[model samples]
Target: MKFYTFAKSVAYSILKPLYRIEAIGTENFPKEGGVLLCSNHINNFDPPVVGIMIPRTVYFMAKEELFAVPILGDIIRRCNAFPVKRGMSDRDALRKGLSVLKDGHILGIFPEGTRSKTGELGKGLAGVGFFALRSNAQVVPCAVIGPYKAFRKLKVVYGKPMQMDELRKAKASPEEVTDLIMAEIQKLITEYR
Candidate 1:
């Protein structure tokens, strides 16, 4: 098996038993092609948890600083994570993300830009919307509930792909697209609750 698949297997073996991870609407995930998996971030484990539930290998953006860590950096890099400089445009990171989509790979993103300390959904950054529109990839909204505590059930719900035809045709502004995507994510969160 590939390193990521093997690592995910190991992680699932450990995390599933402790958190009772339950995934719903997994069928909503596209079986192939480029896809953007957008979700809310609650903690450091969010990316791996979401990646583990999805059937495809997910290439996610991590903070540039994380890539500087000793052994942990090597692990995340091997898992297909690229670094993004937080709090700035970081065009290089954006280009790398687009390249992943162009190569027909899944790109996982947390639209909120950072973890919500209160576990509440927050405003999405415009970068995600820009990526979705530029790449012309379908976006799957995901909601991750409860993995906040060990030994507690963690729920992940994947919503249907957001329809972008109308918006794309209308040449919607970045802000407008971001708002719509955020609203869809909010709906998924509500559904989980």
Candidate 2:
């Protein structure tokens, strides 16, 4: 816990001046229970940038390759990041994410699966929807705007908890749930940008 706080503060100090980062709509975040923090991925810096701003501890699912790097792997692991295989379904990763939510913690996921090279929001994968449907976590859509360039203005907007009751009642497919979450994220980007 101490290390997480220290890392968050250091990250905030470095990122705040560099990106002039601002967080909006944080009040939409629930004070308790499990949460799925879904967002669009633009760069490698997205996870730390968004995680630092949120008051709750965010456990993120990073690409499995990152966990193989010598120093970075250990650091991210200590900071609550677990590895997930990209380009395929990794049941282990899914179970880890579900366990996090089931334990009433925040799990951060980039629904697009990977970073976008063109700085546009990509289509969200169904994995996030699967997590939302299987767990009791509240799915929250977020948007990260502006580039990671130094001194540039950037914003992280957290939208309200999605209306999942209807979808759940109807036994919505994972693809359908993903579409709704992605659409909300797009709305945030349009409004905040």
Candidate 3:
């Protein structure tokens, strides 16, 4: 198996025991083509928790700071994660994310841009909507419930993919698209609760 797959398997095996990981609405995932998996960020484990549940190999857009660490950085990179600068419009990161979608791969993103210490969903950054509009990729809204604690029942529930055909044709603003995506994610979280 590829390193990414192997690593994800190992991580999932370890996590499965620590947290009761359950996936809901996984049928909503697209069988192929470029997809943008947008989810709420609760903690560092949110990425791998959601990523491993999905059948596709997700190329996660992680914070650049995580890449500064020694072995942890290498592990995430080997698992198909790339860095994105936080708190600014990082063009390099944008291009890299678009490229992932353009290659018909799954690109995982946290629209909130950062983890919420309170576990309350925060406002989504416009970058996610920008990428959705720019790449016209399928946007799958996901919710990672109970990620902040171990031995808890952690759930990753996916909502239906949002079609951007009309929105794209109208040239919707990034903020508008982001709001819509966040709304869907919120709904998933509410339902999962």
Candidate 4:
């Protein structure tokens, strides 16, 4: 927790000046309990930026490849990141993610599954939806908008926690839930961008 706070402060000190970072709609974020922050992926920086901006310790499922890098892997590991295999269902990763949320910590997911090369929001994958339902965590749609040029304004918008009672009653499929979450992210991007 100390390391996370230190890293967040350091990241903010550097990034705020260079990116002109702006975090909006943060009031929509809940102060307690488990939260699933689903956002559109734009770049490698998206995870850290979102992690630092939010007022909670966000444990992310990083790509397995990132864990192979010597220094980066260690750094991210200390930052509460664990590895996840892309393009296939990795049960171990899912279990780890669930454990984090079950312990009442926030989990951050880039629902698009990978970074957008063109800075546009993409279709979300069902993994996030699965987590939302299984963990019963508050699912909050988030948007990170940036071209990431130095001194350029960048925004991270957190939308209200989704009402999942209806979806839960309807017994929604993971894919269907993901679609709604992605649409909400798109809405945030449209409204805030």
lDDT of 4 by residue, 1-193 (tens): 7887888889888887888989998999989988999989987888888888877889998999999999988888888899999999999999999998888889999998899988888888999889988887899999998778999999988999997778888999999999999999999999888
Each candidate: RMSD to true structure?
1.1, 0.8, 1.1, 0.9
The parts of candidate 4 lying over 4 Å away from their true place are: none
lDDT measured at residue 117 in model 1 versus the true structure, 0 to 100: 88
Q: Which lDDT tens digits does candidate 3 get at residues 1-193?
A: 2999899999899887789898899999998999999999987788888888878899999889989999999999999899998888899999999999999999999999988889989999999999999996899999988754668888889889999989999989999999999999999888887
- Sort by lDDT, best first: 2, 3, 4, 1
Best candidate per TM-score, number?
A: 2
Q: Which candidate model has the greater TM-score, 2 or 4?
A: 2
Q: Tell how far residue 121 is off in model 2, in angstroms.
A: 0.9
- In the range 1-193, model 1's lDDT, one tens digit per residue, is 2889888999889877778889999999989888888998998988888999877899999999999999999999999999999999999999999999888899999989899989999999999988888886888989889856888889888999887778888898777888888898889888777
Q: What is residue 76's positional error in candidate 2, in angstroms?
A: 0.3
lDDT of 3: 0.91
Q: Each candidate's lDDT (Cα)?
A: 0.89, 0.93, 0.91, 0.89
Query: Best by lDDT, which number?
Result: 2
Candidate 2, residues 69-142, lDDT tens digits: the string is 99999989989999999999999999999999999999999999999999889999999999989888999999
Which lDDT value does model 2 have at 7?
89
Q: Which portions of model 1 miss their true places by more than 4 Å?
A: none
Off-target runs (Cα >4 Å) in candidate 3 are: none
TM-scores, one per candidate: 0.97, 0.98, 0.96, 0.97
